[model samples]
Target: MTIAVLAVQGAFIEHEKKLEHLGADCIELRRAEDLNQHYDGIVLPGGESTVQGKLMKELGMFDIIKSQIKNSMPVLATCAGMILLADKLEAESKVHLQTIPMTVKRNAYGRQLGSFHTNATIKGIGEVPMTFIRAPYVSQVSDEVEILSVVEERIVAVRYQKQIALAFHPELDNDLRIHEMFLSLCK
Candidate 1:
């Protein structure tokens, strides 16, 4: 399968590496036109939400990604990517994507120093080691969304049909089960 990783500015390379390690073709997407190309799925890696949002708008990729999601493209968003996929966000008044029906709180896992790793039973992946780096938390999810994983009793991973939003960075871990699960979602 061909997977495109948003490369505006983030840990997108990590996602690309993971997908490549899984024996899948990976592409780095930088502009709105890049989205026009065919791909089985896309991954939005962990990064600074504000910076990514600005870059997406500056490069005119915000709308293209939204349109793709509307068409039921399988998308996996992690960390800052989760913020972009959320329908509502706290402390982010100007930059909000509102794509997924959920409320996200940026840096809910605390600052960079607060980053940690733990074992969580992800819905499909099972007891997987997850890395949370200045991650956000899903405060609430719409009825259509299904909870995939949680940390400290807060929703960390959720899926609305083919759209998967994860507050933690699955690409950072050596395990490729999550990426494999995403690949399975591809049409």
Candidate 2:
């Protein structure tokens, strides 16, 4: 399974490493040309979603990715990646790809000092490690969006069709279940 990981910004390297560790071919997508390669799925890592979206647009990769996502390309979006996929922001105006029908509140956990770690039960995946660093929780999800995991009664993970968005960074943890679950979507 070849996976194209967006590497223009954020924790792309960590994601690439995890995917590789799972015995999947990892490709770092740094430019529009990089997106030309054949890949089974995409992984959007934790980072500044706004910056990543801006870089993607500037590099001419945003549209292609959005289209791919719309067409059912499996995606594992974490942290800021969740924000990028959200259709709306709680109190923000800008919407990135807006592919998922959900509302996200950016930095709902206060500042960097508010970061934390915890274990949560993903609906179908069971218990998994969740490392939240300046994460954003899902404030609302449409009927089509399935809530997967909740932390402190807040929506921390969700699955919509072939796309899965997590408020916490699974790649930052030692658990491979979440990543494995994502890879399973490719098959």
Candidate 3:
């Protein structure tokens, strides 16, 4: 299956590499037109949500991605990408691609120095090591969303049908179970 990674900024390249290592065809998504290409799934990598949001507007991708999610396309948003997918953003004012009904607080894990890794039991993926780098946490989730993983009692990973929002960087870990689970959702 083909997976498109939003390459506007952030850890998109890393995500691409992980997907490729999983034997899935991966592509860098730049323009809104790129979304027109056939793809089974999409990944929004961790980055500055404000900047990425602006870039999406500049590249005319904001609406297209929103539409795609509305059409039931499978998507995985990691870290800042999770902020983008959230229905409510508690940071700077910007247009977020509200794909998931959740309220997100950017940098909920403190500053860069607060970044750390830990072993967590992720639903459907078992116990896996996760990297949280200035990550955001899900403050609230709708009834449709399922809590996939948690750390210190906060929601770290969640899924709403085909859409997955992960607060940590699964791509940074050696385990491909999360990515593999996402691939399975594509099928």
Candidate 4:
């Protein structure tokens, strides 16, 4: 299957490497026209949410990608990507894609100094390595949202329909089960 990795900004290259290692063809979505190509799924990597949001809008790709996710296209959003899909932000007024029915708290773990790594048990995947870098946790979720993983009693991962949002960067770890799970969803 072909997957589109948003390369506007963030750790997109890592996600691409993992997907390729899992035997999935990947396309770097650098511009608006890149969306025109067929992709079975999309990966929104960890990055600066505000910057990514602004760039997507400036590039005229925001609405189109939002529409695709709204149409049930499989999406794997991590860290700031989780912020993009969240319907609401705890302290921020601006919402990006707003496709997932959940609330997120950006930089809940503080700044770069707050970055950390740990092993957590994701509901379907068992215990796996999770790397959090200036991550955002889900403060609340609608009935349609399924909690997948929690760390320190904080909501770090959830699945809403075809969208899987996480506060940690799974790509940074050696584990490929998460990416495999996403590819399975794409299939």
What is the C-alpha local distance difference test score of each model?
0.88, 0.94, 0.90, 0.96
lDDT of 2 by residue, 54-150 (tens): 9999999999999999999999999999999999999999999999999999999988999999888998878888999999999999999999998
Q: Give one digit per residue, the lDDT tens place, for model 1 in 82-105.
A: 998898887666555677898999
lDDT value, candidate 2, whole model:
0.94
Candidate 2 TM-score versus the reference: 0.99
Q: Model 4 residue 139 lDDT? A: 95
Q: Model 3: which residue pairs collide?
A: none
Clashes of each: 1, 0, 0, 0
Evaluation by TM-score, superior candidate among 1 and 4: 4
| Candidate topping lDDT | 4
Global Cα RMSD, each model: 1.2, 0.6, 1.2, 0.5
Which portions of model 3 show Cα errors greater than 4 Å? 91-95
TM-score, structure 4 vs. true: 0.99
Per-residue lDDT tens digits for candidate 3, residues 36-154, read 78889989999898899889999999888888887888998999999999988776565499889988889998999989999999997799999999999998998999999989999
The TM-scores of all predictions, comma-separated, are 0.96, 0.99, 0.96, 0.99
Per-residue CA lDDT of candidate 4, range 66-143, in tens? Answer: 999999899999999999999999988999999999999999999999999999999899999999999899999999
Candidate 1 weakest lDDT stretch, 10 residues: 90-99
